[model samples]
Target chain A: MILGLTIAIVVVALAAGALNLVLGLLGKAPNDLSLGALALVELALIAQVVTAIVAPLVGNPPSGNPIEFWAYLIAAVVIPVLAVFWALGERNRWGTVVLGIAALAIAVMVWRMQIIWTVQLA
Target chain B: MRVRASGDPLPLHYSVSVPEARSSLATGLGRVLVIVYAILALAATGRSVSQILSRFDEAPVAFTLSALAAVVYIVATIALVAKGPVWNRVAWIAIGFELVGVLVIGAISLLAPQLLGLPDINPFGRYATVWSDFGAGYLCIPLVLPVLGLLWLRSRRDAARQAATVDAEVRA
Candidate 1:
């Protein structure tokens, strides 16, 4: 189900975030490992995008207007991508903050997706 | 031509002072602020425009407030990211307005939700601004950003003051 994938993504994102935080605390930004983690999260988000597209196609549409769903979905995909790219340009705690914001956005997107699903179920 | 530390004149490959070369934490953190504000700018604008265009008749008050909030965020982001003393002053003003807007709107939304409610087609039938429900949506960044912005500005000012004191001491 979409819920399962979302939970998995959240777990991956949080674990990666923890690693990034550790690197940040150690005063290491732009580390290979952190960048690797960011890459993984980005890949996972790609999976999310695919899932979002398939969700309504196969089943009842998620709640809200299609325009709204698609709009938020597009934002969901774009925000983290932009954050990661921008963060990669800098090698400091600021970069870590960028990752932090990306993770936070993922969480919000998942929450929104869940709400959309719930509205449909109702 | 530039003289090396050994006092032999060397070819001037590049001319720059140590002060100019040093990168401050503000530059780094300010960049971070820029990214965050940009995200908010996009989110607010998108939501407001969609609401206004898609369902202007549903909740005119809420949609209009959303549009206004988007404008404020956009202005604040631009002012904050612009480089120069003039932009710094503008950033302060924009952020000040943001702080006031959020607080006043948040309080009103909570105490008088009816004042902001807009009729809609679906069951929910109403729209709310970023300040509504204390920014329950978008994780309340609208509520949080102003405070962080003020703190960041104060630290920058403090650093500037310290630098000035050091300069005065050196001159004396």
Candidate 2:
């Protein structure tokens, strides 16, 4: 379940990031596609957070580095919020750039989380 | 003399300014540098702290380097975000060091993998610094950042020069 969600996060993030990369290069106005990509990443992150919370509750907690796990969790939550602020601060290609950065960060964290959980499974 | 916000003198140039106009050559790329730097700051700090707490005995040198990398990343990020002349200087120095550090350390780690080798050597000693294994861990941003940073600095410098020339012509 976690693996599937993690893959979903990466796919959505990469799609958004690639689109943002294109728009950012063209110097186009920030568009909803970028925003939608970011929103999808956020939704996937929220789901990951819920899974992380419930895994421990269910007594099947991840057995990897707890510090790493928590760090990933905190970063996942904070990145999107900070991104929204940064995106809103600029209306040009910069806004899309911000969204791209945030989404990329989310993807990395998701990958890290997967590594942590997989280590536990191993 | 211009006033700077209170912070210890950064050991190097760690701040830079955004160019007056985003060039077609560097628009997405510069933003990529900023994003990568932010992630490095977070990752390096996290690894350093965790290493220190979990196992400080093994690879003291590498872990310390990790911590230092974290500091540099934080400094670079601040320098990148802070605008103006002071920050531009700071960013230049910081990015310069970053490039040097990555190249030097990357070479050492790559040619001398033994330096990072250890199983029970220490808790995290079994692992390596960001420079270890040729930066295989963090996708080699350590190698890439300095190159990008240099480009970013040059772009900003060019913009500054252009602005100054325009100002001079207007005054004349």
The TM-score that candidate 1 achieves is 0.79
Query: What are the per-residue Cα lDDT tens digits for candidate 1 across A31-110?
Result: 66777777787788788778777877898456655555555566666876777776766667777766766666666665
Docking class of 2: acceptable
Q: Cα deviation in Å at residue B60, candidate 1?
A: 1.3
Which residue pairs collide in model 1, if any?
A: none
Alpha carbon deviation, residue B41, candidate 1 (Å)? 2.6
What are the runs in model 2 whose C-alpha is more than 4 Å off? A120-122, B1-32, B114-126
Chain A TM-score values, per prediction: 0.79, 0.86
How accurate locally, in lDDT, is each candidate? 0.68, 0.68
lDDT of 2 by residue, B1-172 (tens): 1244588684343433223422222233454566567777877787778777766786677778888888888888877766556666777888888778877766767666456443322122335666565466666767877787888888767876797678668669
For the predicted complex of model 1, DockQ is 0.37
Clashes (candidate 2):
8
Name the docking class for model 1: acceptable
Best DockQ goes to which candidate?
Answer: 1
Per-residue lDDT of model 1, residues B1-172, tens digit only: 1123876664353332223112232356776776677777766776677677777887688788888888888887777655446667777888888888888877777777667773222222237667675566656788888888888877776776677677668779
